[model samples]
Target: MNVLFNTDKLTRLIANLQTFTGIRTNTFDAAGKDIQLSGGHSDFCRLINASPEGHARCEACDARAVEKCLTARNAYSYRCHAGACETVLPVFESGTPIAYLVFGQLLDDSSVKQQWENAEKELGWYQGDLAELKEAFLRLRRFSPREMAAYAEILEALAQYIQQEGIIRSAEYSDLQKLEMYLDRHYMENLSLKRISADLHMGTTKLCTLSKKLSGGRTLTWLIAQRRVNAAKSLLLKSDEPVSSVAESVGFSDYNYFTKIFKSVTGITPSAYRKTNRS
Candidate 1:
């Protein structure tokens, strides 16, 4: 399920908070999928990212925490799978929970050496350089329990904001968020109206109507293509992979067609864009 909050506004808030609190934060839907800042994942998360087994374990950890918050009917904090403290604040709608404002991955007050040893054990068998992981652990934001409570209050306020704004901008934007969530999950695939509408369980026409309204008149296809182009741009700028491979990675199968769309959307060829960005 999508978070019932303004992601852009929340992102801006998270960014600003980092400047003051030096703590990273993220919001997740009730299902544990990140919807906002989710701040640069902790160093230990980087290790888990490398191994599918460990990633699954971490997901299960998140699932359990989400379950506890949903069942307990209150916001709470728990230690992450990687030995860092984290909190989950459920955002409710009309007396039902819809999303969670998650803040955490901070180190507890203790000996740094012991913390690393415990983190290595908690992270289990994974493949990133342990030294790097240690560095990341050392760099994590640390706070006392009192400070954490104060930070969580910020997320609570934002959650309340989402609940209020949602009343004024309900169904239309909800449909928009649903579409965005779908695109975020399936952006790597060859997507189309029939498939997207099917997933949302709505007719293509209504889907298009909502997409148009949500995007201020841009068609559903526009958003899909834009998402792909944006991904392609990231790959182009960040990786040394070839243009054709980058195009394919972002859901474009035909290299020439990918170039056409890339140029059309970005006003430059992929190679040129890459070179310019590199320079």
Candidate 2:
């Protein structure tokens, strides 16, 4: 992973993955330090601080084993933890393992009996009657192998998304940035995709397509609306500006329209939001 790329981007990507696919997301460095985590799928934080016997031995063992495998792999990949439901997938950009995308947590369910023999050996446990363990494992819902494969495919898609983002950043053209900055400066003064596109020497349609792709569904108008709404939030928070004035400051000509949109996006009227959230 590039040190220049901060955790903010990775965190945001994890959030996106969770939204797009119902799977947990996490990122660990090449040396196995967790950089960002979402979905709260692991108890590593608590486990690391606890005494040996009380801590999460299974999670610790799995993380250590995954790190070892990652260290040895020539390409980005992951090995399924010898457990019933969990599998770790590594996200690679240009053959360098930058992140790990772990999914499939159906380990505790029906898989126990099906994989009982295998998991016991993998965990280095004696094959005594696992009736007690099975009882405990049955508490959580289990997924089948097919379901696990579906989750793996989702993880693979997320990896491709992160990879595409890396490729875009590496290219690092200033056209998109310039267009956004220009909009920020002049959105209140009447801006259009045609004008911004002309300034950037890009066709309007192509610019719109690229902008939508980069923004994850925000069109030019929606982006402008978001900026205006964000400005409205700041004004609502900072000074005691009237709603109408705040709307004007944020490039919203119609106070009613601004209020409607703001309420739609935030689930509360600006006045109510300011009152509740503002200091």
Candidate 3:
């Protein structure tokens, strides 16, 4: 999914928050892919990620937290697998989540000793140096219950600022725009009219009509060809790969057909286009 946002601005905002709070913050797309402003992972987390088993458990823990946050439709805080407290807040647009803001890699002051005992027992399977892990764990910041609640409020307000300022947004697309986005993302795959129709939930005939109307009488097939040719052109200009290799990369299996389509779209052969454009 393509999330529209001012990445630099979002980074600045989150970085400022991290600087002020002494806590790490990160942004993730709806699909759980990191966006930017990772603020750096805590030493505790780095240690967890370094162990293969610990890494897998950490990912599972994060996935569950994201799912819970989506279910609550608000910030959800929980004790991580390794016992640090973390919170996740989903940024919603039109009742749909576009992004997530996650903060908190700290412990609660009231439960530090008990939580550490739990963490040590839980991570007993970890193969790394246990003493170093304990040192990192003990170094985590601690907040009282009241302070944690206040931090949650601060995170909520930050989420609101991100939404109100349009730092992250989900674009509402027209049918044509939807088609274009789908094609752009899937152009490297084996695409057919039937597959497009099924995916878009539009009848094949209606899709054909819409394609013609939006594309000035061009067919969907032509649009796909044009998309592939455009991608090929970028590769041709930017890389020294062979034209045939470029053809395969852009979904054209047959070199002869790729040459024909390239010529038909750009009024020049791929090789010639590359030679002239590069010069």
Name the best candidate (by TM-score).
3
- lDDT of candidates 1 onward, in order: 0.78, 0.62, 0.85
Clash pairs detected, candidate 1: 26-38
lDDT digits (tens) for residues 1-279 of candidate 2: 342244577777778777876556566554455554575643322222244542355456457756764776422233333343556666665566665655543454344565556655654442333564445444434556576676667667766776666621322224566667877787676677777777778888878876786578788888788778887888899988788998898888898999998998899999998999964
Provide the lDDT at 265 for model 1.
95
Order of candidates by TM-score, top first? 3, 1, 2
| Model 3, global lDDT | 0.85
- Native RMSD of candidate 3 (Å): 12.5
Off by over 4 Å in 3: 173-279
Q: For candidate 2, list the clashing residue pairs, or say none.
A: 85-107
Question: Which consecutive 10 residues in model 1 have the weakest lDDT in total?
Answer: 165-174
Off by over 4 Å in 2: 1-6, 16-22, 42-50, 53-60, 63-84, 108-136, 167-279
Between prediction 1 and prediction 2, the one with superior lDDT is 1
User: What digit string (tens of lDDT, one per residue) describes model 3 on residues 1-279?
Assistant: 567878899988888888888878888789766665777788998998897898788778888898999899988899899888988888876688888988878988876678789888888778899889888998999987678778888888878788877788765334566888899999878999999999998788978887886578999999889899999999999999999999999999999999999999899999999999989
